[model samples]
Target: MTDTTVRSTGRLRGVLDRIAEARRGDSSESLAAVFLLIATLLALLWANSPWGWTYEAFWHTHISFTVGGTGIDLDLQHWVNDGLMALFFFVIGLEVKRELAIGELRDRSQAMVPLTAAIAGLALPAVLFLLLNPSGPEASAWGVVISTDTAFLLGALAVIGPGKAERLRIFLLTLAVADDVGALAVIALVYTDELHWIPLVVAILGLAAVWQLRRLRVWRGGGYLVVSLITWVALHESGVHATLAGVLIALLLPVYPPKRREVEWAAELTKRFRQSPNPEYARTARLGLDRAVSVNERLMRLYQPYTAFIIVPLFALANAGVALTGETLLAAATSPLTWGIVLGLVVGKFLGITGSTALLRRKLPPGLTMSQVAGGAALSGIGFTISLFIVDLALTDDEALADQARIGVLVASVLAALLGAVVFKVAPAPEGPSMELLRPVDPRRDHVRGPVDAPLTIVEYADFECPFCGKATGSMRQVREHFGDRLRYVFRHFPLDEYHPDARQAAEFAEAAAEQGRFWEAHDHLFAHADALDRDGLDAHAAALGLDVERLEEDLRDGDTANRVADDDIDARTSDLPGTPTFFLGVTGQTPTRLEGPHDAATLIAMLERMATAASPEAPRS
Candidate 1:
């Protein structure tokens, strides 16, 4: 090739790389929603095409698996809805487990706002859906409008939501969890066929087996899979929704925060892998890393991609293929079933969530505005997945009625997206005020650890004697242990003189130890024994750490060390930091940005990784 051709190829490759990198910036929900939208459109297109009969022929095809007439059989559509969609519900169950175990739902006070909103969101929509179709077969279809398609709602938020809507997203996600729970209960209780007593008993036994397996600390994936399969088959045989088996199994999976010891073991393995680049070491490190997170989180990461990108979309293709004939459209135009679903979803969801939010305004997490809440509530009406899922179950005997219900779902979802966009446009969330650190990380002045020239820096303003700081130090320590030499950690003294009289002296002691090149040693010792920070106690700690007590005494006798500790306090006061254990993070050599909310090690490392990826030279500007 000529030089011009080679140059053009290079430019094209660069553009492609940037495009891929930019796509990485999109949330999982956004990608899932995009795929679901494509499938919905394709299904509609295929169903209306000249070969429309083939669409029905394709999904109606039988698929069976048997071991001497013992296994089950289902059509392509039933397989997608019952078999593949189980994985989707399984991922949801994992999320629910994690949240109840350690996330926002664990805190009753913190969870009440979203929980109430979700309850309202659930009840009002069903009530509205029932009001119009009060006496007919359509009234049972109330479950259709009671759920919000979380992926679509989140995708719409990503597209047209206010900038920095993480808080709003979190609020909505919490609400959606309750929505999912309510929907699943309705499916199990309100939509089951005739029960088979023996199979139901066996299903109960399977659930017990799952719970026992969890309690016994079963580590093998295959063991869980076999038992879960047995439970699912039994449930299906019992005339129950087999998808509920996913929930039963997942709810039994243990979910918990990574203990410090677990993280340390992973860090040790990672360090060994780094030192010796061997397959054995690498595998060991990977296993250790996997073990640090709970089984629930691991399974979610494993299955969520398949559920979001493939299974759910295929379900849409099988279920969403409704031909809108002129006669059908005219009938649906005046159908109360159609209007009930639309109003129940689009209007009911907005009023319920927003109204609940209004009642619990004071209980909301800080930084959430009414506009953001309203927008999120509007988006919650996009009830696509479960709406259509319920349509099939509720109107099993009437294909035409099911199609009308599907029409309502599709219409409500589109309108909800549009309505959310408009609400977000008209009442946008307020932009956050700038929060940059007053003092940048300085190698000469700050107590820096790891590589001093590391690309990422996290500066912490902590009081040595504060119990809160002691707890925060553990998280920071885990972060340091994980990142190793890739990140720099800076410690600044922000001793609250009024609260802890000895805190200032503790800071001076740490600075004095710095003069002897043992600052970090003293720092760790101080926090480990924060309950005892008097002069005699600190002197004992210095002696234990082999620091020169004479030199420490000499430094404390003087004002220079005191002045150095005071400098950090001045920076904290001017920075408007509320108290000790405040954290700021950014790229090295830039003003660090203050961290808000809980500063868990996992969250911190993830945030830093994103920052590093964006700042890397190879990642071209998009």
Candidate 2:
């Protein structure tokens, strides 16, 4: 194993660190799930009430748009399923693109566990469904069982999962993403029986045009909107589900961590706007800030609310309104179609996800025990939104069969949520997991910058190429100056190499320098020239620090240097850190407490100065 390989192996288990950081404080998932549940209840009530005839009558009402002797027409339910749901899928597509481009799924090796488990989760459900409904019209609705509604899964976890279930959430989020992709593929490939070749070709052409626009750096939303609409229409005209238009177009849109240059430019513009207080400067600053973030994130921010808060609940209202008369319920009780969906979602999902993960438990992040995996697996059985969507597609010829499947869906969702809650309430909590550093700092093994036996110490879990960590340079510089020989500062490698592609290599360079007894020098040099820490740049750093360049290069190749970095990485991840630039302050020979922010220079300096004064020899006793 090379140095890069060591870091890669460490990251393979720690990929959830990035996803957790991305969604540290958000809680809207539960609220959105509430809306979906309410809508489902309302749908049930309306379909079974004295006004039940009104339910069918209202949804069957036709709506049409015609211009230039050509137009589109569909009933109200179709409008919700085909029109509004496309936006929902578009939001999902944006998230998918974000993950594939820069999020946890970017690293194929690191993503292998969840991806494999998700495939099992998807396949086993379909197989179980087919086993029950073999060689029949009901068998075609197998797609109904192959999905987990992400919104409901998240909401259910928050309500009933363990207190500190962040790691579990991250792991399940990755699996859910893969599950969604698999479901979308089934929707595109299996459900679409008829095809219009010419319109399909036109749709492909429209997608190609959108790709070209992306390549040309066209940032205008209007330009993409016009093209996306054209592609959606063509796709709809073709026999392929129009919602797939959102997925294809979103995949073409770019996603990346904000670049340092663009961020600096945005900052400069904002500074100028503050000084000038002019409209022109304000406009420039706004544009600069917009340019700093990627198009993928911007679209997500714009559309995700509509999808989560409105479209999804509306979809539930449209699709979940099954008439549950006594006869319908009695027939469904003995229906193979109903039983297949129930077993496929609840039993198959649990067995598939939990079984696959157990076989690959070594790749799981520490503190993510099998208990939590079991609970999350049970929750993956909530196949509501896409299940109903597929029921409409697959059982369009038989309304009674569709009703049975819908009841099965409703029953499975409730069962899955209850099972998740029960598993979580009964399971033992993680074995006394602690967020404190799992490994203590040692001068011989750690990158220390001052006296080994100093009175005060600060340990930083950092990524070399993280812009936020890079921004902390001023605070660290001030601390160094203030403490001089009194404070010992330690650097531990915690590279989020998915977002910062060059960070792992830069950390390896630091390790190479450690072998040459110049780790601190290499640390400062790498941070100072963070953007240029590629292979040649690291070579330049080794040579400039009076280290043997050939030996440094050889050390990086030998993998021992990377092993040192990976050891710290494993410790950092096991501790469940918030993210890079996390700090711990403590006295020598004692466990450090994490320093919750106001991590700015002036505030930290003042706080530390007061601490120093209180601990002084001449201070008054309290």
Candidate 3:
């Protein structure tokens, strides 16, 4: 390659890497929200521009295909709605599956609060919409008002500064997922047309084939995709919405990790690959790694970004281009359809979610206050993407009604976001210390990075395999640089074993490296190569750090190193650590303030400076 071409390729690779990294963090939701908003604005501008006729003409253009004497025909807009949106729904199905299997929905006791709130949120909005437009074609559009858009809601929460009220964000996330389930149910049950038996039977048979494939442990993506597309086509021919096919396939896919024996076999193969260094062993090791995770998680990691950034944005551009002329705006404002949707989303969601939570307060989780619930409820009103989706389905034959519903959704979402931001801004921070450092720091036993006598001590509970944890490593290093000797940094293990399969062994490897006085080296190396951390990769890291590979392997084989990592995990659980890269900062005896998520370097430094000031002997205790 030429030098100039090489530089251009390098720059392109750099950009792609940055995009991938960003997609792995909390910022991915924000980026998705930005793209959605930009697409919406572009659609509006295009519709209102002098060339607006082209906008309508282009989307109305028909595309048709035929295969084996069967033909399919659809306009550009219908293709976006029925096809690209299926991928969007597929991602939602993956999220719902993950939550049910391991995330917030796993613990029914903890999940009840949001689950109940979501139920109320879904019902009351439809009730309000129905009351306004009872027994009309527009009444069926009630589903548009019932869901909470996860991307827009989360992006709004980020703007409102969740801070100590981080639990509020969690509540909203769970509620939104449940809301999505409800919306999908509505689409399947109410929006579907009369059934066609033959194709429906064929679809059922295809699903049965999928279940058989699962039973046979078929993990190949291509095989599943082909079967799923057949099922989708059958469903479409059966008069059911084709998009539900994605959800059906997703729910049936296995989410459980490989069995213990299989994981052990993979580990053994990885070890052999390390010893032999041949292509055959290498391929076997790679397959072993792939088998260790469920197909659900693998598919999610592969397709989530495509759904979030590409598919949804395309959906918005296709659907949100309603002309905003004075007569159209006036008609929308005066129509009962528009008012019903606005009131249903903005008023009904807030009242239903907050009131239901209040009524069930005695039975729900205790950490959430009424004010926090109110803030969350207000934010839940930002129903944009799925609402527009339902508008397309519910008012398919009436262009005027569809346009009005779209206008109402756009307007209500903006108002709800602003209102929620104000509420969160004015609400009181949670009572008690902002965060408590439940585990005391031990200089002798813990991996320490700075002076022991530093005024501010930061203890972080993190997992090596977590992408957010890897990002926080840079922030922690910046904190050390900004504070120099005045900050003592301690690391602890809190691997999310269900999500990151290789994390536990990686933690053990780090502990083993600590035995040879290279804990930080191993720590940096593990996070820098998070995607490649297997048994052999751990050994390679140890060898590169000048540690005795044999001794490291011996330490890993021993139970003591694993026990040490387990102790950290126990401490984290006891402290109610919510997620990875949780930090606690304070002096030795004082209560340390806690923070979570992948915070930026400046935020970490500012927080530490405040803690340092408060920890000084000259400062008075509260």
- Which is the leading candidate under TM-score? 2
Segments of candidate 3 deviating more than 4 angstroms: 1-25, 258-260, 267-282, 362-367, 430-432, 435-622
lDDT of 3 at 160: 77
What lDDT score belongs to each candidate, Candidate 1 first? Answer: 0.82, 0.82, 0.81
lDDT of 3 by residue, 1-622 (tens): 3333334333433433343344333667788889989999999999999999999899989998898898779999988888878888887898788778755676677689889999999999989988889978988899999999888888777767455444566678889989999999999999997999999999999999889999998987788999999998898899999999999889888875334345556666766776789999999877776676578777887888888888888888998998999988999989889999989999999999999999887764334567778988998999999999999999989999899999999988988887787877788765543368655677877888999877778888999999999999988888888878878899999999879877987998888888888888889999999996754466567778889876776676444676577668866765667889888878756867687644788887777666656567475322
Question: What are the RMSDs of all candidates, in order?
Answer: 16.2, 11.3, 11.0
| Residue 218, model 1, lDDT | 72
- Stretches of candidate 2 exceeding 4 Å from the true structure: 1-25, 276-280, 431-622
- Model 1, residue 187: displacement in angstroms? 0.8
Candidate 3: how large is its RMSD?
Answer: 11.0
Provide the lDDT at 493 for model 2: 90
What TM-score does candidate 1 reach?
Answer: 0.68
